[model samples]
Target: MTECLDAIYQRRSVRKFTSDPVDRQIVEKLIQDAQMAPSAGNLQARDFIVVTNTAVKKKLKEAALDQKFLVQAPVIIVFCANTPRSSRIYSGRGELYSIQDASISAMVMTLAAHDMGLATCWVGAFNDADISEILMIPHNIRPVCMLALGYPADTPDTPDRIDASKLIHWQSW
Candidate 1:
């Protein structure tokens, strides 16, 4: 439990990454770990698109508002939400649930990568339509976020946090 907490605390949003390539096996492991994250009604309405090709990475960089890290990192995994899968059981709320499922999965994947001595940075600021077109994603699945993954070239200092007491609400705010 301590180790898990340690990993959680130490994990940072690494922007500068070494050029070292991440192995396919390790990426697969990270995905597997992400799948362990809980989903709404166990729908698991999420899929990951791994990008290693330089050309695709460059295009992704463009789609992500020209974040150079997208191309610098050895791997970029685009987490997506499958609305159809969630809506099949959840009806009107399924699309929202699918987005939640993908978000949680991305969080878990970042933590898992930290545990494996790898680094990850979540890229949320992107044009959804551009991402979909660049990745050739279908209509049913929407790209939630992209994770830039690799060995860290820079370890940023942890910024100060707000007091937990102030943020935590009791029975009511």
Candidate 2:
């Protein structure tokens, strides 16, 4: 239980990455770990697109509102929600659940990467249509978030968090 909580506290959004290359195998391992996250109705309605090509990264950088640091990372993992995959089962609620599934998986992956001595930054600010066009994603798949993955070049200081009592609601809001 402590090990689980440790990742939550220790993980930081690392933007500075070393020039070292992240092996495909390691990235694959991270995805595998992320897949362990529970999905609604066990639909597992999500997909991870691993991007290593610099040309593509440049396009993604632009799509991400010119976040230059994204190109510095050796790998970028695009977290997508396969809406149709979920919608087939749950109809109207499936789309929402698919997004949740993808988000949960991404959260799990950030911690898994942290545990494996790697750093990641969750990049969510991006043009959805641009990303989909760049990635050549199908109609059913929606790009929800991106993960910048690489070895750390600089360690960031811990960020401040809101007080639990202030943020959390007990029985009602």
Candidate 3:
């Protein structure tokens, strides 16, 4: 399999992370790679907040349904969408498109992290208002998701997935 495909297949949502710190340069490169992901109308409405401070991460852990992994991870990337930016072009659909853009970017970051021998867990179950309050996210920017990134502390068995035959539909549904 191709290197990219190998990385994609091997990628998993790592929940437990070690205390080892991730390199700043590696993190920057990962974000830069994520920027290359396609965006709606090329607006690139996604914004990211990298939190490494222990205090901030602790607050985030609390805000994220008391997920201890958030605090254990060395870095937490908060993905947000700038609705107004996409709204300039798509009107009513702009906000939705911005959300899609952010999600795509976050996925790219996850894959890139995996390829770099790092692990990450995409977290969406959080109180948006609480995260915004802790991170001071602007009102116009919506918090879409967060990613906990760091070295793996344990290897988790792959979860079962639905068979492809059951999931795939022909040309029409």
- The TM-scores, one per candidate, come to 0.97, 0.97, 0.96
| CA lDDT scores, all candidates in order | 0.95, 0.95, 0.93
Better of 2 and 3 by lDDT: 2
Q: Model 2 off-target regions past 4 Å?
A: none
* Candidate 1: residue 89 Cα off by (Å): 0.2
Return whichever of 2 and 3 wins on TM-score.
2
Model 2 poorest ten-residue lDDT run: 160-169
Q: List runs of model 1 lying over 4 Å from the truth.
A: none
Any idea what lDDT model 1 has? 0.95
**On a 0 to 1 TM-score scale, where does candidate 3 land against the true structure?**
0.96
Q: Give lDDT tens digits, candidate 1, residues 23-111.
A: 99999999999999999999999999999999999999998889999999999999999999999999989999999999999999999
lDDT digits (tens) for residues 58-151 of candidate 3: 9999998999999899999999998999999998899999999999999999999998889999999999999999999999899999999999
Model 2, 1-173: lDDT tens digits are: 59889988889999999999999899999999999999999999999999999999999999999999899999999999999999999999999999999999999999999999999999999999999999999988999999999999888999877888788888988
User: Order of all candidates by lDDT, from best down to worst?
Assistant: 2, 1, 3
**lDDT, model 2, position 150:** 98
Give the count of colliding residue pairs in each prediction.
Answer: 0, 0, 0
Q: After superposition, how far is residue 10 of candidate 2 from its true place, in Å?
A: 0.8
Model 3 poorest ten-residue lDDT run: 152-161
Q: Evaluated with TM-score, which candidate comes out highest?
A: 2
Give per-residue lDDT, candidate 3, residue 25: 97
